[model samples]
Target: MRLVPTPEQRELRDAVRSFLAAASPMPAVRRAMESEPGHDPEVYRRLTGELGLTGLTVPEERGGTGAGHAELAVVLEETGAALLPGPFLATTLAAILLTETGEKEILAGVAAGTTTATVVLDGNRALNGAEADVVLTIDGDRVLARTDGERRPLRTLDPTRRQALVEPGGEVAAVSAAGIARARDLFAVAVAAEQLGVLRASLEAIVAYSRIRVAFNRVIGSYQAVKHRLADMHCTLEQAESIVRYAAWAADEAPAELPGAAALAQAYLGRACFEVASGSLLLHGGIGFTWEHDAHLYYKRAKADEVLLGPPRVHRARLADLLEL
Candidate 1:
C-alpha cells in the first residue's frame, strides 16, 4: 500500500467523507445511536452494497475487492470522524480474524456484508456485541465460532458504537491460531486509524469554531492562548496520523515491522486522541459542554477507544517487549 494516498485512495476518502457528511450528520448519528442495531440499515447497505468497503481487505476469492489495509484505513477514518453509528469496525474485525485464520466460509459472508459478527473479548464484554449474526473468540489456543446467543446490550460512552454482553452459544467450527496474534496487532493499528480521524475531527471543530465564535469583541482565535492550544493539537494530530499510516503500510508492505508499528500507533494515538478532543471541547466553551453538543460525542469516543483495542499502557508495554527493551 502507498504511504501517501494515491489518487484513488484520496478519491475514496473524499467520497466516504462526503457520503457520511450527507447521510449521517450529527443529528443522524444521534438518531441512529438511539435506534435498534444502533445504526441505519439503509446507510449500512449503501456503504457495503454500493461502496464495497466491508470487503476492502478480504481476498477476491472470498468475495472481496482484494484491497489492502490502506483502503480500510481510509474508510474507517471517515466513519470515525463522522461518528457514524454502525457495526462496520466490529464486522471488519471479524473479517480480519477469519481471513487471518483461513476461515473462508465465514469470511465470505462477512466480505459480502450478508453476515454480522462480533468478537467477545473475554467472557464478560463483546465488541459490537449487539445485533450480530455470529460471535467469535479466541478460546484457549483455538479460534472459536458460533451463532450468536442472547445478547444483552450495554450502555457505553460512545453511543455511535454499541457494546454488549454476548452470551455463550453452541459451537460452529474451530480454526487454527496461525495468524491470530498478528491479526490482533493489525486490529490495534486499525483502531488507531479511527482514533486518528477522531483527533483530526476535534482539531477541525475547534479551529472552525475559533474563527467565528466571538469573545470579548474578537474571534476566539485572536487570543494567543487559543492559538497555542490549537497549534499543539495540530502537531499531535499530525503525529497520530503519521504513526497510523505507517502502521497500516507496515501491515501490508512490510510485515516484519507490523507488531512494533501497531503497538507504537496504539500507544501514541490513543492518548493523543483524548487530549485533542478534550482540548477541542474546552476551546468551544459552554456550548461545547452541553449535552446536545457534538464535542462530547467525540470526547466520549476518544475515552472509550483509548481502551477499545487495548489501553495505551498495554500497547506501550507491548511496544517495549516487541523492541526487546
Candidate 2:
C-alpha cells in the first residue's frame, strides 16, 4: 500500500547509486557496449560478490538476501540510470520464474551469481540470451529449461542490453499457470521501474543543461518555451515515479492487484519514458543529436524499452481486458 520507499529502501537506493557512479560510469558503459560479451565481467563480479545484488529478492533459504520487490526496484532504478550492461535483468527474471517453479538448483546458481539466465518470451527471443547459462521458456503451466537450445545474438538499438533469438528445447519441470502469471507480473513491474529511472535521469540532464547553456545572450532556462517543456518533463517524471512504485509495491504485497498494476505501469510508463527521453534530447539542441553526447544513449534506451515487453499498446490492451472494458 505504501508507494514511497521505506528508510531501508532509501538507504539501499543510495548505496546502489553510489556503487553505479563508481563502477558503471558512462565510460565503462561505452566500453562494455563495444566488447564481445557486451558487459564488463569484472564489474558483474563485483556487483554480485561485493553487493550481493543478484540475490536481493531470493528467499534466505534459496541463498539470497531475502529482500522483496521494493528492494529490487531500488537496485534496478540505479542500474537503468547507469545504463548498466550485462545479464543482470535477465538473470533476475530467470531467478524469479525459477522461484515460482521450485527450481531450486538453478535458483541457487542464479542467487550465487554463478549462472545467468533469460526467459524466452514471444518471438522466441530473450534478453541477454547469448551469454545466459540457462534459457527458460514458459509453456502452458510448465517452465522449461532449454538445455539444447541454440542462441543467436541479435543486434539491438541499445547496445548496453543484448538480445538473442532462442530455439527453446528441453523441459525441466512443471509449475502452476498462476505462478507463471505472477512471475510475469513481477517482470513487467521491474521493467517499469527501469523506465522510470531513465525518465528521471533524462529530466535531470536537460534541467542541468538549460541552466548553463546560453541563447540570445540569456540563460536558455529563462526562456518561456524552454521553461514550459522542462515543466512538462518534470510532471511526467513525477507521475512515472508514482506509477512504477505502486507496481513494485503491488508485486510484493498485493498479488491480486499486481496484474492490473503491472499492465497500467507499462501502459503509461512505456510511452512517458520515451517522451521525456526524446524531449531531453531535443531540448539539448544540436549537441544532443551527436553520438558524443550521452543524450543519444538514453534516447535509444527509452525507445528500446518501449518494446522490451511487447510494446505499449500490448500492455494497454491487457489493461483494458483486465478491466473488462
Candidate 3:
C-alpha cells in the first residue's frame, strides 16, 4: 500500500509547520519551559481561534473544523517539531473522547477553546483524579465527574506539558462502558501518531547534525561508525512511521484493527523515539548536554511522551498478547 500522505495532508502539515515557526519558534519553546504554566495562552488562543486547530477533529455540527485523524496527525507532527507548549495533545485527546461519546457541552467548549481537559493515565489510571472541569472515568461504565479545583504538580522531564494529581469531590454523569473503551482507544491512536512526529523530527535533527560536524579534519558523518548509527536511527523511524500510519488509518476506518494497531504503534514508536532523541543528544557531544541546546528538549519530550499513555514495554507486551505470540 502507498504510505505517502495525501496532497491535502501535506498542505495541512506545511501550514502547521509555518504557524509554529512564527508563533512558537525554538526560543519561544525555551522561554515557555521556564515560565509558570510552561505555556503561552496567547499563542494557544491564536492557534485555536485563528488556525482552528483546537477543533480539528470535532464534528462540524459542533462548531469544529470537521477533520479526521489524519489531519490531526499533521498538527501533532508539527507540534513535536516545535515542542509547542500548552495542553494541545491532552486537550485534543480529551475533546476526541468527549465528542465520540456525544458529550455535547464538553465538545462545544473544546471546539470553542474554552474548556481544556487532559487524561490522567499515570499513577492510578483513574480519571476522577484528573484535574479538569469534567473528569472521564470508567468504573463498570464511563462517568464524568464535575469537581472542585484540586491540582498538584508532577515532576516531569518535559516541562512544556505539566501534569497533576486530582481527587473527585462531587457527583458525576455516568455513561456506558463501551463508550469509554472507544474514547480510550481513540486517545491511544492519537498519542501514538504524536510519538511518530516526535521520532521523525528527532531523527532528522540528528542526521543533519552528524553530516556537518567535522572531526579530525573530516566530517563525522563520513565515518563508517557514525553513518551506521544514523542508518539504524532512520530504520527505526521508518518502522515507527509505518505503525503510526496504520494506527491512524485503523482508528478512522477499521474499528476491529484499532487495538492491535494502537499497541503496535505505541510499542515500536515509544522506545524508538526515545532512543533516537537520546542518540541525537549524544551525537551533539558535550553541547547536547547543556540546557541551551535544543536536543535535550526533544529528548525530554520523547521520554515524557513514551510514558504518557503507557510505556513501550507495556505496549509491547500487550501487542504480544493481542497477536497471541
Q: Write the per-residue lDDT of candidate 3 for residues 104-205, one digit (tens) a residue.
A: 777788788877766556543322133345544444455444445666666766776777675533323455666676677777778777777777887887
Judge candidate 2 at residue 240 and give its lDDT: 90
Candidate 3 residue spans exceeding 4 A from truth: 124-135, 169-173
Q: What is the model-wide C-alpha lDDT for candidate 2?
A: 0.89
Judged by TM-score, which candidate is best?
Answer: 2
Q: TM-scores of all models?
A: 0.96, 0.98, 0.93
What would the per-residue lDDT of candidate 1 be over residues 162-243, giving only the tens digit for each residue? Answer: 8888766554445545477788887887888899889999899999999999988999999999999999999998888888
Candidate 2 residue lDDT tens string, 1-325: 7987889999999999998999889999999989988999999988887898888898999999999998998898889889899999888888889888887888898889888888987778999988888899998888778755578899889878999999876776888778888988988988888888899999999999999999889999999999999999898988898898989888888888999999999999999999999999999999999988999999999998888888999999999999999
Clashes of each: 0, 0, 0
- Once fitted onto the true fold, the runs of candidate 2 whose alpha carbons sit more than 4 angstroms away are none
Ranking by lDDT: 2, 1, 3
Each model's C-alpha lDDT?
0.85, 0.89, 0.76
Q: By how many angstroms RMSD does model 2 differ from the true structure?
A: 1.1
Cα deviation in Å at residue 43, candidate 2? 0.8
Scanning candidate 3 in windows of ten residues, the lowest lDDT window is 123-132
